[model samples]
Target: MDFPCIDRLEMRQRDLMAGPEPTYEKVVTGYELFHDSTPFVCDHGGVLPQMDVAYESWGRLNADRSNAILIHTGLSGSSHARSHAKNSRPGWWEKFIGPGLAIDTDRFFVVCTNVIGGCYGSTGPWSVNPATGQRYATTFPLLTVNDMVRAQFRLLDHLGIHKLHASVGASMGGMQSLCAAALHPERVGRLVTISACARSHPYSIALRFAQRQALMADPNFRRGFYYDGVQPHVGMKLARAVATVTYRSGPEWELRFGRRRRAPDQPPALCPDFLIETYLDHQSERFCLQYDANSLLYVSKAMDMFDISQSVTRRLAAQREHAAADLGHELATTAAACANVSVCMNIEDQPASTTGHSQAETEDEIAQDLIAGVRNAKQPTLVLGVQSDILFPVKQQREIAEILRRAGNERVTYYELDAMYGHDTFLIDVVNVGAAIKGHLENTT
Candidate 1:
């Protein structure tokens, strides 16, 4: 009668421990990882350690190991990108990756990692900092997209994956995918950089700044170290609310929600009125519940600081990968390059390479150019984008395609469409999206 494995006891425990976070993260079937170094030392003195990574796998890796497809998540997303075949709740990327879906299990072996600084079971401000024997909170060092990619590299190594068919993602995830291909092209055969850019744009920076201010403004926000029970929930919500606006487009919001009020006849207050409003509210609520506030702030900044042309140039100086390399190299080597990229924003009144909320601006173009050195990458690259998406627009996807084409990349393909839901199309319209992805990867010999 006192057996601890009793359903009643376990159910109660689940309710008590689970609020909004992934309570079963420790043993989720598809979600797994290699938890090793958090302090993945970077070029800067800022040491990025103290991390736990959550990951999910789809399909089976081929004996050759080159069939593994890597997926990177955008801001606030974890490794639970799709639902298991029979699972009730649709996985985050169920549309694009599933048994018969786009990134089909029948064909490609897929791997997705919860980036460092992520709160979804991955080490973040919430995880106890080994150095301090307490949650790092604000005490955790600043992180970058490179750190995330590096961590993923180790995970790939742990999994015995020698190469990937393609690496893809949207928004920040898109940024990571790009960085991965750029830095480790040899490790990945095909590169799919969806709604992202070679560098961060000013509009993106402005949007991120608005979101970050919401968190720091909260009195509970303790710089980057508020792990002690007190969390900036309101700030995080506000940030999400703001970001929700950007993740889609004006036309999309109008078409989908279109000012529809909620709960039939109840006046609008703290509750949502329209179906889209309700949808955003649900996502934000779940996000605030599961995702850590500080981790969001830090990761957002990491995306902002993600340019690497200098390092890239040095890496690929011996041989050019393709025109993607030649153009980027020419740009980085030109005076106009600074103006075209690393824009001079007056808001922070700092050099583009030193702006807060502007990881893209601060990005060393050299680091980004490293993609040029890779020779004979075999993965098929597929870049998908929503027409109305403002966050990472179809234009951005085109830029990525151009880069691949310029690289003399024969395995690259691009698709841009009218997913009226805007940036969320990839997440929402998975059937169509996934089907497209599946078709392309499958059709190829």
Candidate 2:
């Protein structure tokens, strides 16, 4: 979509184009992600048979199609990843994905899709279920990272893309990248999973559960059936606040909100508060303003179901527990049938498949390996992250680099960016990060 005089307009105009009108406003020279309708599959096991795939692009696709770089964004991110002919605020990751930047359009074909449950143009919980003609709302499918990846695969298929030069993402996006690798290994030439784990960590699940609870607990949350009228802002904001803490680091919080007290001039001994409180307050408010409660539940639940532990776990407790009077009987059972389960690791992620009890390092190591895959791939991978990143810590990025080194994926490299702006850096530091990504893309090919 060509860049409309978008910067001149506020949040109001963006809503109109991506919201109601069915037209493609130009975003750049030749790149555009037209506003199109996609169907949400409800008739088939609550499947989104058709869904909107909003996107923007640059440069041109070579006839060979080998240059396409498929980008999957994190939770709450849209397809606006760069600036167009006339816009200023640029796009989300516009910093790293344009003309002369890392994901240089001149050299690569880039395509970013709004995930299935995303509020963007994608057909999500808020999307109208073609059957009922009402927003799917709570009726939306219980989607997974694999589902999101499947949706993208279909989009690429629709675009006639049989193979990809690389697939990339951070946080939830990173999770999608890994899922793509696992589910459809041959499709990607290179893969990157930055600051993300193979499966949802228990702590992460707890936090998301809390957020969901906050939203559902609200009188507005009417079960998964809130579409009748009442919306759940208070519940969603409370959940956002819970998530916000995890996105940032404790030390960062100390620096951001630790010094100042609200009652003016209170000393440190007063357990003083700082400006960060106000910052989180405003962020939580704004987040709730744009996102829907049901969307939060769907995405967060998807993350919860991810079993990054899948690829590494070679044995299933159900299979192990079955009284195999005859070994031949095992083939008929399923993994989820087990009562108490423990994953058996392989030599790749662990020294041995020892499973007397769950080892913290075992879990952390598996997650670390996934993150490392992004930084050190035998193929090309671009990693962009914040220095004081409270969300996906710089330490995590460093760990990613180390893991890449260990994995022998030396081709992988990282861009440790400066976004003092904290966890929202990916969303806020678009200009600089976009440039960094663009440069990386240019250097790779």
Winner by TM-score? 1
Candidate 1, position 267, lDDT:
55
* Cα-based lDDT at residue 197, candidate 2: 54
Best by lDDT: 1
Q: For candidate 2, lDDT tens digit of each residue in 112-171?
A: 877777766666777775545666666555666766787788778878888887787778
- RMSDs, each prediction? 11.2, 11.1
Model 1 per-residue lDDT at 62? 83
Q: Which ten-residue region of model 1 has the weakest summed lDDT?
A: 338-347
In candidate 1, stretches whose alpha carbon ends up further than 4 angstroms from where it belongs are: 1-30, 37-39, 48-51, 85-89, 263-283, 308-380, 443-445
lDDT of 1 by residue, 4-95 (tens): 22454246336534443333243234566577743344322233333467787878888888789889998888787777643345567766
